[model samples]
Target: MEEYPISFPMEKARTIFRCSVITYLRNYHRFAITAATFVGIPFTFAILITQAILPISDLLPIVYNRLRTLFFAAGFPPTSEFFFDLSLKLSQTITSLVLLLPFTFSFHLLAKTYVVRSFRNKNGSYMSTFISLFFTQIWNSFLVLSANSLSFFLVSFTFSCMEGFGFKSPNVIIFVSASGGVLYSILLAHAYIISNLALVCSGIEGSVGGGYIAILRACVLIRGRTATALALALPISMAMTAIEALFHYRVMRAYRNSNNITVIMAVEGILIAYLYSTIFVLDTVVNCLFYRSCKGLNLAKIDGLENCSGDDSAEEDMKNLI
Candidate 1:
């Protein structure tokens, strides 16, 4: 039997994360070059072009008004500053997603596939994996969208019920809104995590039910390890968020203020994009390690059960002979 070294222990999220960093650094040359070429440059250009061509600032007010209308109709207070900020952030995110959809479906997917294949030491064709990942991403997008919809529906329903029961005070509404927002965040976070793991499963498993099946497997594998998964994901999420903020400040804000894109600004933007791509590569590596850890743990449990069963059978046989 080939012994599977439990390099990534499920119990120690920090250890797994550290190992992932080590692995990425060990293969830094290959991962960095490939990711920079296929992922970073293209994404940088895509973002710059999109921002230049379609300024999100122009669309922010439109989205804000739409959100305001929806909230007013939902009976939410008109003076909620939190809702206003949330609406703006949501609008910016939506605009960015729409603009970057092309690169996301193409170069980003290819980058993830390459990392997965490299980790597995597989030199096979990428066609199958790419196809599988394409579908998997679509399903993940749907799942995330559905989760968001459900969260909104639940919150709206709560407000409606409160109104129906005559609890229309501003304090009561604010309290309900806060509780509903917390619940919404929790649900969306889990959904996002599961969707990310599903992408990993599709890349590794290679089309064996990589769509809905991969999602189901991710949900199962993450059963007892949810906290570890969250912990492992936190740093990467924060790094990516910080990088985004940096890009906005250094690139977008500069462009907005000057109405000109200099060579220096472009270079800085590209560097930021490269850093973001590297983080994506690291995130993929971490997810792959996490998957292996979950599998190793599951296999260990099965082996333990088998050993116990064998011991019980031997004892029963001895008793029968006696």
Candidate 2:
């Protein structure tokens, strides 16, 4: 509650990354190959398929022309038309999202379980971790989708009401839409951030709500030290964004200039898949970094916890509600 500036500095980030990499490296050979291969394969495939198909539902035609032209120039082989044809159908998106749901969710759960087991200095099977993570992810996904849907519906209704009032200027529309989008995005991000923190906290103390509180306390503790957290977060975000941009640019550039259409098509597909995997890896690192930050901090003495009133009556209340 005190007005202190919390910061997630670069130095802290670097320290966290360094320590985590060392830990990951020490255990990498033992689990890295299997983790990357077995876990990575389905995860990457699901992400790629979903990404390719999702936008097609309502956004494809707007960009289809560009895609067609880009592929033609990229030298996609004679049968490349089949790929484009596939993209036109709604089935691709539905299929991709469906296929990806299990893999992505499972992978997330597995990753968290491993991290948890590692922190406790205990061995946990990948399958067990995966199943736990899967259920948690499903809940999280549902929470997110429902929240986003509600927010969008409200925004749309608001816009309709505004327009009905004869306030239909382009400027008004843009402002309203942008404001609505930003608000929704912020709310979504907050939910994700809280859930993520909760995941880590739960991993450490075996309670999701405890994890959320821990994160809140850490954020409060870092109020004045926020520059440190920001330093850590900004560069990582920038680097990830740059990698994504480069991936798209290269693929587009290749499509623009290539002549051996078939060869180019294969390369594009591979690259697209690779890009998806890369994003996943990057996200994994980011989460690892966050966990590392908490790991290094001397937060056991967090003052906020003292005020939380973990009283027996509170537990009783929770049980009654349940």
Candidate 3:
């Protein structure tokens, strides 16, 4: 029920980022080992094997056609080849998420719990923290899925409404689509920021109410700090995107081109995956620091208010005696 200061400046966000980097570097060995074992290995093997067994190329066409039909039926203009490519990428991402859900709930969650504990310099039962994180992750995942679904529905509804309103020109449809895309991106980004903070809050709180309480706290904490949260998340997201591209180019492309996986290739893939995992750990560190900053600001505000009230009361007492 505590209130947090909503006016989080970009400068504060930068400081949090710097502190997170320093923290990661200071404990590099511990974090590296934990990330490599729990996150890197499992993520690498899961991605490599899944893509090997069920290549995205095979899934691309089906996803592309389905998207095409949906859009066209909604009275939207035919999209460019870029649309096809985008659909394929989205399909691959969804497939990856689905395949990695188990690891996400287990190994990835465990890594985050450890990172949070270490960052806070706290000692406790790993099993207890892990269990709390497990349930929190479940709720966070559900919220994320719901957000995605809502965004998709809204976009489709926009198209349908435009069509019903007789805005059938190709230019008009394209413009509307662009506007909708921007709106969708904004909403989705906010949802992700909230979800990230909720996970960190849940990890830190370890309360009996689990994710639900943490999520509400995140909402309150992030009230006016949306820009700061987005800024903090952007770098990590870009790094992860670059790593994914590297994986696709170096590992998946090689496998597809030669139709054979070499030992050297496997090692390179693992290395790239490890790099991704490190970024993931850094992301958790950043979130933890952001949470602390928000909480610190809230505490400062409360103290300031209490001091003002006490001063006013003392002034009134003095006036009465006079």
Best TM-score among the predictions, by candidate number? 1
lDDT of 3 by residue, 1-322 (tens): 2223334456556656765665566567777786656655676566556655556455545665776676567555566443444456566666667777777787778778887665433445778777877877788877777776676677778778876888778777667667766776787788788878887787777755366777788889888778889999998999877887788889888988998989989889878878878888889878876787777532111210121123443223222211
| Whole-model Cα lDDT of every candidate shown, in order | 0.72, 0.48, 0.68
Per-residue lDDT, model 1, residue 167, is 87
Query: Tens digits of per-residue lDDT for model 1 on 1-322?
Result: 2222233334356656765666667568767778756766676567655654554367656766887788779776678665666566566656777778998899878888887776443445788888888899988888978887787788788878887899888888778778877887788789878988998888878888588888999999899788878888889989977887788889888988999989999889888888878887888878877787676632111211121123443223222211
lDDT over C-alpha atoms for residue 193 of model 2: 55
Q: Which ten residues in a row have the lowest lDDT in candidate 1?
A: 299-308
Tens digits of per-residue lDDT, candidate 2, 41-148, equal: 456555544453455445455455654564345333224334355334324433455656666556645645554544433344545444544445555556556666
Model 2: residue 253 alpha-carbon error in angstroms? 8.7
* True-structure lDDT of candidate 2: 0.48
Clashes of each: 0, 24, 0
TM-score of each: 0.82, 0.56, 0.79
- RMSD (CA, Å), candidate 1 to true, equals 9.1
Evaluate residue 89 in candidate 3 and report its C-alpha lDDT on the 0 to 100 scale: 55
